[model samples]
Target: MTQDAQKDSSTYWKKSRVELRAAGFDPDRTAKTTAVVTIASAWTNAHRCNNRVRGIADLLVELLAERGGQGLVVGAPAVSDALTQGTPTAGYSLVSRDVVADCFEIGHYAHHGDAMIVISGCDKTGAAALMPLARTNAFGLVLYPGTSSPGKVSFEPWAAKGTNLTIMDYAEGRAAQEAGRISAAELVELERNVMPGSGTCGAMFTANTMSTTAEAIGMMLPRGASHPADYDAASDIHADVRAQARASVEALYRLMEAGIRPRDIMTLRAFENAITTVYAMGGSTNMYLHLLAIARAAEVPLTIERIQEIGERVPLISNLQPHGPYAMTSLHAIGGVPVVMKELLRAGLLHGDVMTVTGRTLAENLAATPTLEEIGKQDIVRPVGQPVAPANNHISVLRGNIAPESCVLKLSGKTLEKGEFRGTARVFDSEADTMKAIRAGEIKPGTVIVVRNVGPVGGPGMPEMVMLTIQLQGRGLGEDVALITDGRFSGVSHGILIGHISPEAARGGPIAAVRDGDTIVIDPGQRTLNVDLSDAEIAKRMAEWRAPDPAGRLRPGSVHDKYVRLVSSAHYGCVV
Candidate 1:
């Protein structure tokens, strides 16, 4: 070994020996001394999504020991967006991503681990897990605990006769109840069955989107992003995931032996691959923020503008989740993300030469993988030529007087059909007020909902407004109205909406000056969002505009306060 390598090995031995001894292991007798940190969100009743992570971590620790490596489990904080949605507690959700990354970073530093294994299952965990691995440039891989099995539910008269249900269905069920289309007991039944067991949400929301992103970013093993979470080794149907878990452990050793690290795998091209995957697969808007944060951690120059540039060239091919008629499990049943990646590769949309944690190029790993056509005659992942939405037809990055830095608009089928919206503004300062207006049936068609003072610094977390959008769909006015916010929306949120408006209201952006009945236009084809008011009028309004009194929500120097102080604008990925 080189002199520096020898010194590093010696230091690792001394540091690990002490930790092993403290944990009741005889240092000299133990042949394995290399510390391998396994970062996981410990089991919690807050949500089923994270309850599987601890078990995966335990499995990793045992497997690492069998392979002559000393493994240590590190707990990272996690929050459920579904559970916290629309509540003040929602302020803690995005903050948890940065907190989880910090926890993993501290744990790696404390253990002096040369390698890491992160098992993730929540909306934030996937991105949080990757940020530290990239920052540290360690030999590590991310394991998605897999998607939760779709829940079974039946609705009559008001809805379809399907059994598949997800959290999105449950959220919209409440809206159905409010609209008198469904009974409260029907909504209750949906709540009980929407999420049956452990794993991430069953749809193409933030969790599953980021899970796919990890693999495409070259931080996860092949075929690791889409397996069902409840499957066991005894079942023939789940044998692939069992083998995937075992293969990951084996790949870890190979990566270590080759001195390959996450940075070596997560290159600019890899980030581009990830962006292409997100666009092709109908991924969440949250992926934009998460990818930006992770790219910053990896010291990559991945910008929201670059993400839009990639989205412009890649077609939305996957027919899944809030945008389509399928769940993530349907894609898994047919071949998972590799099927989509292979199609992109064939169409020259992906960087197939990027390195991956498997100690091979992405193209090499996918060489033998089956495509959607070969897996079956499934339409879950459409061929690139027969895309769900053409390039630049899905996600539009818009800049206007309202969002000078930029904002994201998720163009759905209905929105694309209409092409443009010019409506009078129906302004609200918070999600709660908007929810109240929606419930009261005060919101009308041809109304552009301008919700400001809820940006990163404004909301102190940039909480998602899924409840509002879902209710609009439930109210039968989804296509007729548009929502604009400096905050964000859930991946499950659809309809004509724009989010992540930078120069947010809290920082005196033009959105703060918007008043009820002002004319606003949203044109996807032109890629612009603008209010009809003059620039001088907007400037005059901003000159007199005052920020809301945050003292009601923010505690001095609390985590939220710190996040508010450090977090950047949404256009920049809202990084701290």
Candidate 2:
């Protein structure tokens, strides 16, 4: 705490008169409450998105000071990254959720501020910030730093270069090299600048997906999802992102005065709106996982089945990618979430009356937001009637012998065109083994890739398999194969992938019983996933199954180590 802030605190208990005057009220009679501003952010520059978090935090400090409120930045744990294919925070020294949970818990218990501005950049941080906000029921606002702009890189033959070559396209680059299409030097060059600067990966990946959900659920202001980190502070709309920081904090101040809390906006009806919005946008599979966690915090009952129920009715209207060809930057061009939500509201898919942080209803926010007519027309966000995927919302809740609790399938991206897949299981206990087999071209066309011992309990953090999925895509075998796991997939993962299976292999689920060459079938039309074996035969096989020895995992004293022992199935949102 600063000396000035300490002095300000001394008088805060008796400052009704002073605050009334500062708020433009007649001090003689007006009773205005002072709002202490707390700034929470994950500000590490390990990624470009983190830079935006830091910048926003600094900007909030300045804005709150101008508003005559004392503010201080609270340090939160940044999800340390090393390798991701194994588990969510596999290679990192810290267990991500444990760190993130503590970050919010500390702030909530400390009562650092009456009103808070949560500044987070990426996927996990959003969930971390969200849970405690709901738990504390504080008057606060969540602001994302925004998606990063696409960096340019060039490869050959497959058009994986320039704005076309996102970091995720590195997998495609590798495939091109092995096919003798691109040279080794070209591959190196593409990897070098695939991510030119900071932002999240250039797809509807976890970061973008969570940010979009935040806006859809009314926890954030409209159109904050797709703005590129704009490190230069210049966004496509309004002014620089710095101005957005100021505006967001100001909104927080106003909401505090109005006595609005996060619980008011994130109601059961609002969760439905969020679920519907996610389906319409072909959002991240991680949504199923994180939304479950957030819903648990908010005391809302939600599950993959309920989510798929919404998906069954809503159409996948946007053509955004890691599944499609467009990026967050493209969404920004046509108008961001406001335009998209407006169209969804027109379809009666979202709760237009849900309240938001800005003290406006969802309908009012969309109505006030200028559309593509003012921003210049674009087709990035398609009409509901003529969507990218009209048959389904690109989300499937599969239940069968394989996943009793239910598994989620994202049929968006390139995976949309595929039908039922029946293939032999090529089981690998870890993502590294799967990646190795993929690089060696040992995987067959009718393969059902199974990576086990990496779910919530075994993986202990349930990492998203971005590298493996992208590698499969690069090999030109994306739709030809099916990957299922107890862990999860990145939003960019397309092509017949199933994840978030309950009773993970480590817990002696059916997945542990499977041997090499066991047949697996995924029928999207029926929303079923099963292995070709009799129930008794499956039972006999599982009777002999055993979890991998945990000698090499995070040590016993570590939080990750503790998680392996206490975390529930992914079916339970992986909560402890």
Candidate 3:
């Protein structure tokens, strides 16, 4: 690990024990390792979320090889720019979990990998790695590059540095600019500094939300969730970063020694435990998507109905933005996600008997943490009795005439004002059209904006769109207006946003048949979303419906075309 002490100029993987040991590798093993652990990472410069991946991957290689095992890197790419409208990509955006997971699966067999140390720095990459980790069912451990530090940006008085800003601030700035509260110049400056550095945005968005939930589910090490990518040199997060990465590598090695695997930890009970935690944290809707994909790979029987049941029982508890007043950095300041899980476990909300990467039970991990009582008193994570939502079940599945396969709704924003909504359908064929209407002041209150043909098969990777939700909120319509789509949403997004409408428009779902001005009702309290129409009328509409063309105008033999042909519906997790 310290150096390449010896080399076979002709071949790799033919080193003698002496050669390995001369490099300071420790060959004395208490138990034999089956094979080199695969270190999977979607390493790219396209996003800061992937910034720490290479460093961490390198550290893992050294740790694994030093401990009488081998390690190698498998990289994948998922590129999208949050700064753009609806977060469009410059190119090559239709990458799939199947491809990313296949890298690990193929490597698991090709190299006889016995365990895994996977890296997920972005939305799809994280979810992608989870599936292969589950499929391998080996002694696997997941660790994020960690969330990004918040940038100090705002246009309140001048283009002065204000509080921490994430991607959500882009909408806030644009909203302020249009309202005449700030100028276009200020909006431009705010956008420039909104995203400070790499790592997931400093909110409970998809990446960080899944990172936090991964810890709660017992696949990640304690205190590994919300550390900043690059913080002050004196900050605790930067003090011993490599040591932390090495700790996970060691944990995976030990897990392999103990003959433990992902399926053992990601069981039905553990998946339930993770769902309960996601509800408590007001986490991303993507968790629903990724969790399903992981369940299928792990062969766990989890369903939308089952998730709705968990939401009914678990209350939204974490106060992190855009769901509440705090950010992910604050969560780390208060002892990270392990402390949060300890609180949930104390409330009997988590299955404490579940296996973990540390070769200990979930209960044991909590018990080992001496700071639980000390940090349990913080406002970062509220007590169960006083949660973010006044009521329980901030996330649930809606079933009726429109979404018989069920659509999901986010009911946990701190500014949320209603539990139910009724409005006329204002349909749009594409995100660009929907954004144009909202910006032009054409979308009004009492409107259910339906943007169809954006599901996994339709968008051809289900390109996430919290932009519409955020745009409405910018126009002061977060609660007054409602939006439903077959696309995905950014986790930081708030409002009466119903995403992942299953049996997507591309597949002739009822959402494709909806017409403008049709009465669309979304009542989370009743657990239903419906269009007021006779079954015969709805059938007639569907019978004559035609799938819309791809928004990206995908070409044949392209990545998007492949996703369209092979991807599953949002109902079954859009898995391939």
Candidate 4:
């Protein structure tokens, strides 16, 4: 071994001995100190992109050493080797887990002997890492790859000049089939212009929402969740992350010394913190599912009703798209999640005593950090009592005859038409078909555009189709067009459309029973979605209507199946 490696090994062994002694181990028993096992798992896809996961592992191992412990890095063989090569100076044993869960199980078992640090990113990998940590009640910290780097693209031109084109304009196919057809590359360029930054896509998509939620819930360090992967600041941030890992291990040791258990801190307050953050951020509807799954994994009884009750009171505050005008960077500039949490506290919306991954009380941490106003102009981060709205405004649960199990809608204001809207239903089975017809000028005013099979189990992933609804605003009848779907709309696509019409078509919801020409009426004032037909007639139609099989040729299963299965088993709002 090289001199540096030899020094690291000796240092780690000495530190391990010190820690064991401090933990009250007999001097003789210290020689048999349990081996700390670190699970450094990365998503298969993220691993292919760059050395993001490997870097996280390297930093974690360094942190473990600083905390006076040794660990073994375990992951897929390829990722394990990459991490081993990158952190050669770190004196940690290397191991491999046959599967992602195997890593957690082995890590949990190792906790009997040693502590653990989990370095993970991406969707599935994050979930996998969290599961075993929760089960083992292990001391762990997650190192996300952060956001993507901003490329050499600029949105200044688009900002300076207005195209007068909306999502509706594209849906109408006016841009797609027009004589002036923009190439796919041009479309990509346009998107790049709008998304000019180095944080995961900048939209309120799944990845961004998950990261933001993670920060809000105190899983990752404040501001630790927003750095772009390729930013020059990444290396320094990586060092900070290493320090956090050391702190985490030290925290676990302190708790064990004091007879405090992980369960003592992982309370309902944490879930409440998560809920408040989700609402304030205008987070992904999928968060509803993810939160539910997380609660289940943690053995917490988080029900849809509890979530809705919280949602009803937590006002949307984050001004990020596809809800508001800003992006993650802008939010971070305005003090990021800390500002939001402070606002929640001031508003009496959050539990101040909630324990965070940092091993400090939420309030204590906030007091130690810079004030929200100091990070940005005061106006950027809204004050608590004087909110952007009275309470959480984006997500609401609705129940009526059409939706017996309950449905969700992104409500912006109380300005929905009070009485029933009697309109001829123009049904489209797919988003593509609906867009095609809209582009062809086939849809007319006073039309309720009913899109079916886009529900949780139907769309499988319940893909956001609100982009199409937003596009409709550019058409002459944008104001007059009302969209109703079994799927969901973007939180930003408020006011123009109604989504999350539950009991999706695949499950034979009332929405599937409506005929193309039937008059459909939605009375938000009364919380109702009704057809002109009598109940008997509706029941007869429902009996005759055939639900579409996702397994059918039209929508055959593939990788999308993972998302579909997640949705199918997901409890109401819970994403599996």
Best by lDDT: 1
Q: Candidate 1 lDDT (Cα, whole model)?
A: 0.81
- The lDDT of model 3 is 0.74
Q: Give the TM-score of candidate 4.
A: 0.73
Clashing pairs in 4: 167-471, 168-471, 168-472, 172-439, 289-574, 289-575, 314-392, 315-391, 315-392, 322-492
lDDT of 2 by residue, 1-576 (tens): 432443244244335667646856455432232556667787885655566676677777777767766555777766633235445355332246546756765764464456667776667786666776776666777788766566565434424433634556666677667756678988887777665556666667777788888889988777777777763324332244666677787788778778778889889889899888877788888788778888888788787667777767887877777667677777776677777788888778888888999898888888866654455556677778877877464777888897888888777834434567889999998888888898888997989999888787777677777677777777788878889998778776777789988788888888787778899988888888898999999898887776677786778788777777777777767776
* Tens digit per residue, CA lDDT, model 1, 448-554: 99998888888879999888899998888888989999998888899888999988999888999899989998888888999999999999988999878888778
User: In candidate 1, which residue pairs clash?
Assistant: none
Residue 522 displacement (Å), model 2: 0.6
Clashing pairs in 2: 48-198, 87-463, 88-463, 148-199, 153-162, 321-324, 323-413
Candidate 4's C-alpha runs over 4 A off are 1-35, 45-51, 66-132, 149-199, 232-262, 370-378, 412-424, 439-446, 459-482, 488-499, 519-533, 550-576
lDDT of 4 by residue, 131-241 (tens): 555555555545556544322222332232232222222232334433234445545555443322222344344455666666666555666555555443234333434
Candidate 2: Cα lDDT at 318 = 75
Residue 455, candidate 3: C-alpha displacement in angstroms: 1.4
Stretches > 4 Å off in candidate 2: 1-33, 80-83, 86-95, 153-165, 231-239, 370-377, 391-393, 413-418
User: What does the lDDT read for residue 482 in candidate 3?
Assistant: 87
lDDT (10s digit) by residue, model 3, range 1-576: 101211111022323446546756454431243356778877875556676778778877777767866675777765543643374442233255567778777765554455678877776677776787777666688878777776665445322324456767776667767866677877888777676666777878877877876787788888887887766322333433566678887787687568777778888998888888778878888788788888999899998778878867887778777766566877887778877687788888888999988999999988966444565466678777777665455777888888889788877744334656889999987788898888888988899999987777776567666777777777788778889998878786788888899888888889888999999988777889999899999999988987776654688878778777878777777777
Candidate 3 error regions (>4 Å)? 1-35, 81-95, 153-163, 232-237, 370-373, 390-393, 413-419, 549-554
For model 2 the local lDDT of residue 389 reads 75
